[model samples]
Target: MHPPAHGADTPLFIVLNAASGRRDTDAVRTAIESACNAAGRRCRIFLVDGPGKLQPFAREAVERARAGGGVVVAAGGDGTINAVAQATLGSGCAFGVLPQGTFNYFSRTHGIPAETEAALQVLLTEPPRAVQVGLVNDKVFLVNASLGLYARLLEERETFKRDYGRSRITALGAAVVTMLRGGHRSWRLRLAWRGQERDLRTRSLFVGNNALQLHQVGIADADAPEEGQLAAIAVKPGRWWSLPGLLVQGALGRLGHADDILSFPFASMTVKPAASGQRRIKVATDGELNWLAMPLLFRVAPEPLWLIKPAVAPELEAARE
Candidate 1:
């Protein structure tokens, strides 16, 4: 879909996740004001307290944008982006990003700007790409939802965040200590993709639309985190020591080694307990704990979510090229 041309009078809505980042919200406001004024675009700025606030505000923002055919910018992390996308789906109000969250995985993968000034510039000048979106159960994710060890990592980090105020070093130390303690748990995963079904024991399952690319490890074939497909990569842990190797292999895209680790493409799947009435696994969407359900049903939404991406790092761009 084509973005509306930025005519002389297009209105803009800038939504920022107030709870995000280390910088003060006042600083964000100043930058936003400066950018919008410089671009000669009339704009409104909203500091979203959390994801839920975006839904109602999103409709109003879209309607307002539609009144003048303007754009709505989701100015936070992936969750903020996902919330705005859900609200503006098919509304013709192009979605933009400000990228002010930790991980910012979606932004990083899509080449969204890392610098505030640069990201703001892209918002004014760059056209967005219509990209695929994934669904966990019925909920939408701009990035992939994951289970298994990574889910555990999120849980641990969250607990640490409450206790330690998101101290990065403390969180990292906790993750390492948790891993070193051999605290990983294995579960029986019953997956049904399309018509086929398989019951396997695994320690972790990662379902992603886009592959995750890291600097030292090259690239792994994660489903494009923003693509519409759900790529499930799983690891079966007979022992705790098996994980480091699995992780390394997964990072290198060599998921074939671990019989416990399985990677498959799926449009949709219903996950149920290996045994009836057993809740063996916890599920996470966009790094937040979604209540545990036996037999998690997952799918892909056919339409793409439009996103404003910043430029990628030179090395990553070269590789993609």
Candidate 2:
């Protein structure tokens, strides 16, 4: 693998969300500039106006990074990372993170540091590793995607996040309120794979590329990135009681092991709305929620993106073994 030259003084693009984490970007920029100057690298700062502006900022950063043969660093939260990742896809440009968001799920999952100094150290010391990314139709996600009840819950959570910051309590409150208000709804879901298709009346479907622990309790088999397939998990809840059972089963690792549950590996799956004249369904990808039309195509891109991450800690790798 040809790594970006060391100490070669290449340019680095820094994308920042000024209001992220209630952080003071001026201070962060001062530190970054000092560090880059000492390492013989240069840095540029771009402050995103708001959530919607991240996409344009990301595209501009990708173009600049390509022109300068440099790496791009998203200096904010998961939303910022998602924007940059979408732009950097298939571009052969390495992506870096500066974890300035609330959850910072993508950075935390990949073992990227949140502290400015340590994160910068990783960018300087480690080579980028190719990581697989998930795509729902034209949208790219580094985390997971969900439809049905979870998607609706995300809509409420967005308001909560805007009012009150992210916390387990916030999510728990939203879930409880949503459930009490009969938030779960049924849909006719048809998933096709390997020339075989299965249709079911289901409450929701969650497709994830990484083994995610929800509510700090559940574990799903999402470990193999090189498998060249996305882990397709379909949850069908027949009743209100059965709905909560999905979460319980997910917590117990029996999610794919139960009769009511269906779990398998597939390269792609598409969601078609069952209701007539329904133009779109709510969907959340990597915590970025939006609405898209049915026949939503989700596919595995097979390790298409490369991220600069710290070397795996020995204990973590050993545990995996």
Task: Choose the strongest candidate by lDDT.
Answer: 2
Model 2 scores a C-alpha lDDT of: 0.72
- Against the true structure, candidate 1 reaches a TM-score of 0.83
- The lDDT values for all models are 0.69, 0.72
TM-scores of the models, in the order given: 0.83, 0.86
Number of backbone collisions per candidate: 15, 0
Clashes of 1: 15
Q: How far is candidate 1 from the true structure (C-alpha RMSD, Å)?
A: 3.4
Candidate 2 lDDT, 29-51, residue by residue in tens = 88788888888788888888666
lDDT, candidate 1, equals 0.69
